[model samples]
Target: MNRRLFPLFAAALALTVAASPASAAAPADAYADEVVAYRAEKWQSAHFDDAEKAQKHAATLKKLGCEVKTGAHGGHTDVSHRCPEWREISLKTHEKAHQWEDWLKANGFETRHAH
Candidate 1:
């Protein structure tokens, strides 16, 4: 590593990072589109108190473009909003509840299963 080459190496690295896809941010419209797609179908986030209900709900969610797994998060159906892993929508705190409600309504969903 010559002293003169050090600056060139750094510049190359910066260029590489700038061109990398991971360095780019996902567009907000993309998230909004996915939310709209999720809302276009019947989306229900509820507790899987019954195994049968959980299975049915998972299947329904899968049909609506979700990648569902075979389990619950603390007795609730873990529905992955986008990624492959499942997420619990049941642990809604006071502020989280309002945010969830607002998000649902904004995405054209009713949040009908917030019991």
Candidate 2:
């Protein structure tokens, strides 16, 4: 009985060792894929000196299918926008921000951190 159980235990240990690498690799592969996807994202951010301009920018980004939010950055009002579905939609949001930036500048509102 002891001899038979020894072989069974050894086999189970061997199997566990053999499966370890594959199980570990799955999460690493998933994290790598997530990193690649995040790197490929086209998220845009802009800073406005005036809260009103940031609000306008946020509204424009919302029209372009982006989820927009406002925050304070370096004592300036900041607006960030992202379209999670596709880069094309985010591109439209970015383009609209550029247009808004140009309009803001023309209207004498200085913009910063437009990236």
Candidate 3:
């Protein structure tokens, strides 16, 4: 820790960082802002902060006959799931849509018939 050598050490550290910017960020927030949208559609999704929880949710969605797509977004997973849309059911009847909404809500999903 000599005073005269401090400047040289600081200059070397700066050069090392400037030489490898990507490596410098690799250990930090590399994927913190990354979000890969599986599809361009405006689909409602389930969010899971843990990988295990995401996988379990995916499993249950699959069991519920939902076609799901899960993408890892930084520290969390976003699941795009759809069993049926409100438009797919008979809007004239509205019975199936209500029933579907109830089923989704019962399964812990926030549902709305705003299709």
The candidate that achieves the highest lDDT relative to the unseen native structure: 3
lDDT of 3: 0.43
> Taking the tens digit of each residue's C-alpha lDDT, what string does model 2 give over 1-115?
1222333333332332111121123232221111111111245667677777566666644543456778987878877765544211111234444543443333223343223
lDDT (Cα, 0-100) at 55 in candidate 2: 69
Q: Give one digit per residue, the lDDT tens place, for model 3 in 9-110.
A: 233323321111221232322312221111112445767677776676666455444578999978899877765422111122244345444444544444
**Candidate 1 on 1-115: residue-level lDDT in tens?**
1223323333332332111111234232221211111132343344445676556544534443454556566765543333222222322234433444454344334343232
Better of 1 and 2 by TM-score: 2
User: With candidate 2 superimposed using the best TM-score fit, by how many Å does residue 59's alpha carbon deviate from the native?
Assistant: 0.5
Ranking by TM-score: 3, 2, 1
The model with the greatest TM-score is: 3
Ranking by lDDT: 3, 2, 1
Candidate 2 displacement at residue 62 in angstroms: 0.7
Q: Which ten residues in a row have the lowest lDDT in candidate 2?
A: 31-40
